[model samples]
Target: MVLTEYLSKEALEELVDSFSCAGAFELEILSPDGEVLARSPKVHSNKDSSINKEEDFIRFELPAEAEIFVGGEHVGTISLRGLWRTGQDSSSTSVGVKDSSNLALSAERQIAISPAAWVELMRDVVVRLCDLSKQVRSRVEELSAMDRMTNTFTEKKDLKEIYQLVAETMVKVTGTDACSIRVFNEERTELVIMAAYGLSAKYISKGPILLSESKIDREVVESRKCVYVADERTDERVLYKAQARREGLVSALCVPMIYRGQIEGVIHVYTRRPHQFDWFETSMIQGVASQAAWAIVNARLYHEALQAESIRRQLRLAGDVQRRMIPSQAPKIPGFEISTIYVPCFDLAGDFYDFIELPDGKIGICVADVVGKGVRASLLMSSTRSALRAHANYVRDLPALIKAVNFDLWRESEISDFVTLFYGVIDPTNKTLTYTNAGHEPALYIHEGKIRQLDVGGGVIGISEDAEFSQETITLSSNDVLIIFTDGLPEAINFEDEAFGRERVYAAALEAWGRGDSADGIGKHLLWEMRRFAGLQSRGDDLTLITIKLQ
Candidate 1:
């Protein structure tokens, strides 16, 4: 049929200027919904320049296919089809064109399309539609799989489960022949394979591979970017291309897994045939890798915390053992009254005290503060106590005993481990109490209704690893009392960070010596004052006190 049809200015121009005389030509276009948007020719135009150019041309949008129109007449259909860049895109199909005469035939003369033409046209339409449908379906499937893979990673917490899911889901989404995930080691200096599918674990987990020179790993690791290879044979920079080709791998994608702004590992996929990797696929892989990275980090953190808890429990047990080693009560002296209080700041304390009576009517009292807290500190304190007690029996003089203990402590402990000590020997028979303060706080004496502090002692033990110590003595009369303690007592502070200074210690001593001179009451009163001053809050360090009263 020779009908005048409206056409776009450009199409009409092209047909008139470029195409041959046409007795009849069909034109078709699609609507927004992909249906055939048909229109007939309005009138014949011999290059009429007066007609509205805007109104003469018709355009339709089709999700599957579209056809251009001129003056409302059908034209050739145009379609956009897509396939994965894989070499498998080629296919064969039978095509048939519509029989236009059948539509205009009278009931009888409109003989059914010759069986051959009918089949041809039907087959053509069906095949085209099927191809379009398949392309759409493939894209939808990929998107669905990407979403599902991300969901699975978020729901799963176990590393093994996550790895398996990642491998399977990624392979399905990308249609890859194999997949693997490699994680960075603790120091984050190298990448170690953590999981794989369709790949040997031995190859993956052999050892951590350094990033500096690793051809394949370095690309993704250094870039913190995704890498893709469409045809290994054509890409000279690809690592293990020979192995990949031998294994039928023609395409690959590597997505780096990042955690907390660092590249933790990479997710790799391999296709058995040459394929195209586009922005969409790269985005999908990165989305999945991001979730996987967070999951791996969370799993590792949980595992590490469990290990630390186990270690902490063991330390608590060790602290209990150390506590058992300390004597619970003070030893009785022949003619002296003694009271001692021991407090530990943590599960185990670095501070310790020991009381030993000599054969010549004398009592030795020792209070020491180890430099640190916890198991190491407690162990060092234990060693110091044992060595000091052994040497106490050999040295009758307090100064010599302290010097020996300092030497032993310095020798037995590590460079960082040291002790500050206040050691004293009370001679009730001669009314004299001698003491040595090895970097320790001065002792307070309440005698003749007066208060005095003895501040003479040697430097901290273990500083030089071999140091000597000296002693200071105070002659006590009847009704005199002496207070020997670690710095924990005088340095004790309240929540305000105020220390109970020497003035307070002196005042407490005077009050006790005046009020019946009760050593036990004085020690208890001092602790009570400290507790009240601190408002029953946490004590930052150990609190210890040793008191001796002369009758």
Candidate 2:
């Protein structure tokens, strides 16, 4: 059988150089059938060419021969040629053959060694030396190569480059036909290839390797061990057997790359010919896989950190812009006092409030809560606030204006998006407040310590294109107070996760109003009461509130 597939030309050359004693020239590794599997191209030729022509060249001939075996099974033979100086005496000893004349110089032949004396001795030496250093010359060389690989791994910061380096090194060290690296996606549903070498891009793009479909990869991931497929074309465990056949990948060794006690990915080495990986090749790849796993983990962490920092910077800049959009101070209307508060748990908030000065001295007040958190919700809040302000003056009817705002929100939102809002106009001259609540936390109209929830309106905005809305108009009176807020106020959670329900909000509002406080005083007092009720626990959502009074 031809062992050409198993041989490494570089490793054989290195092995021959290590045993390059005096009178040794060429080394040939022949298969069981005497076909040359690998031969060192170091020093060789008959007396015909360069050796005789160049004075710097040494003379040599192929003569010594020995069998190479593993576990007492003869796999191949090593035939060595010996080096002889051109000026050596005729009686000087050779390695195995009788004619050093093939390498002889000046048309004279040097003596050869007795076949019986050194053939068996050189046979044991060549076989044992090759067996000991087939992969590497010594343990030190292995360690040196490993050290170099480790340094290379540590120096890498990009995941794709690291994977590519590891894949290329695997084929070089193991003498395999190809190598690929794949990592489990965040959901672990798919094995996505990060890098590959010695394989065509067409074969790699054959299909996604779904975990459920690839029994071999699933086994490697679940067991955290290497799996061998001697023949992928016929292996039932292989998900893409036909594709593997097209790729000419006959055998594969899948090694799990485990990081921090968890299997994160797999490293696969393939052979063009069917091959059972030996212990040395398996261990070498496993060692490289271990180092590569750590490098991959570090690269992922570094990339994620960069993304997080960029998001933080963006959110910080957005928060600054959002703060400018919100009314720094409530409009100061004649014969009326208004106050407002906005507290965001995160740098980016879903809640926003705006005051739009309308025609005929009617001031438009809006408090809206977009149905989400973070940057996305804040974006919706900005757009919704802008749309509502744009329609406030054009649509004098409260219900019609609410409908217009709802349509704008619906146009921009996905199915998961919507906004709860309270939009109202206060006419100081007419002493009337007209309002519409679009699925908002109802505004409380308080008179003489009684709380009336003004909650008449339609469903949430942005859910339906033709959502209907309703409105209410109330005649204002001296000492009458009105409060509007988002769900964050009443739904605030305590340390024990208990909500400060609507009743608590009413009680707090009444208690503050009973203090005979102005609108600003009452708003501040209500906020303090709610914070005290929450037991200083961090708020989970954006909190917003507004207080208005006719004094």
Candidate 3:
């Protein structure tokens, strides 16, 4: 509770108006710093009073002072001054003299009668009015403090900021030297200082306060009640009595911060002189601590939610960048039709594919899958794609190009990272397909109702620095269909723990080929069959497929 809370400027002005009217004189309300808060009406001063300079006037102040109090806090003083016209008779036309003309005339007409008695009566009346104003202002200040505390708790949403605000506000309301808040450790074995105001850095750096050693703090935590010490130096319950004396802290009030039926911490208010905390002061501090607990809890929750949202946004951005690395549509080659599909189980995928057209009208195709999932795996996949593309341009031999890509991957990748890739060069004019499979799923070649599995290549990339690779060539006849896929299709499992194995894939591909479906249609049909087999089970890995049909 403070002065401004009880007696606002507007309310003080109204009081000044009432006092001036009753006393028939001017009044001014001055703060402790001599700043005028309210002033009564001055009739003659508002106009030109220089013309009447020679007129005799009696000016005097009230004998008694009227002290103002707001919730036990002395705010300012109210003074009264009177101006009486002594030269004129009782018929004087001067303002503010009409009401007190008889008293002035009595003092002037007789030397035996004194105006001291009349001044004493006026002082009594003003003192009574001032006492009444103090009572009213006290109530107003109490209510205002409570309202402000409630609003502060509702508005602030950061834990550290809320702690600082609560500590500072408590110090102001209680008129204490300093305030501090300390929260319990997670293990409930110690109290750690969280926020403080009006305290020196050296004082705050006092070593950790163990709960067992600090009696007052332990009492507040265990009993969930406030404890007060009027003399810190003499109280046996004070833990750091020597340090408190050194800091000139004479009194302390410790209040528990309870939230959801559990005591979380304690707020301590320190006074420079020995003083007993009254019921009003103690209750006000406890109220502040209660609101502070709620604010601290809510702020932490808000921060966690914000962090989760930020991570979600980053994942979305990474997924978009990874998708763009893959070809949007299959490249168009003369006498060949190609189609592809890629599905990632999560936001970011470990699988990627690309098609690069060489200078001799031949096209290079690549489909690779990293070992892991998520962001790390996606990063490795991107690096592998760049290395393969760079080496494929210069190294025309399938085995040599793959070996160069492997060396680059081994040099750049981590020990746990590896990629299984299948790359091929298609020469439509020669009707020959040259390819190397680096430990990937074997490519299926279907021609004239016969199926051939091509599995001729070295191990996966990024496993060894000097691993050798080999290539295989196959001649394509009329109406030949080639299917390249990752292991996701065969490894897809249902609720019954059954995998959609290679046999099922072969059967589906055979049926699609017999139906005379195009390359796109065949790839989609196989994917649909796999989904049907999984039946409500989530995808366990990334799925990718590339199909080429020679017309």
| RMSD (Å) of each candidate, 1 decimal | 12.4, 11.6, 12.1
Regarding TM-score, does 2 or 3 come out ahead?
A: 2
**lDDT, candidate 1, 91-160, per-residue tens:** 2211122322222322322335432333234224434543455566677888887777766766776888
Assess each prediction's global lDDT (C-alpha) against the native: 0.66, 0.79, 0.80
Model 3, position 1: C-alpha lDDT score? 30
* Candidate 3: Cα lDDT at 347: 86
Clash count (model 3, backbone only)? 0
lDDT of 2 by residue, 1-551 (tens): 23333346665555555444323344566778887665555544445353433332442344667776654777777776545345534553443354543444333433354332344454566556556554455445655777788898888888788889988887876678899999989998999999999999998898999999889999998888899999999999998889899999999999999888988889989999979888877888888899888888988899899999998999999999888998888888888899899998788899998899887788888899999898889889988988887887788988888888888888878889999999888888998888989899999999877889988888899999999998999888898999999998889889888998988888878888888889888888878877898987988888898999888
Instruction: State TM-scores per candidate.
Output: 0.69, 0.72, 0.62
Model 2 alpha-carbon drift over 4 Å, by segment: 1-137, 175-177, 185-190, 200-215, 231-251, 271-275
Instruction: Give the C-alpha miss distance for residue 291 in model 1, angstroms.
Output: 3.2
Best-to-worst order by lDDT is: 3, 2, 1
RMSD of 1: 12.4
For each predicted model, how many residue pairs clash, with residues at least 3 apart or on different chains? 15, 3, 0
Identify the superior model by lDDT, candidate 1 or candidate 3.
3
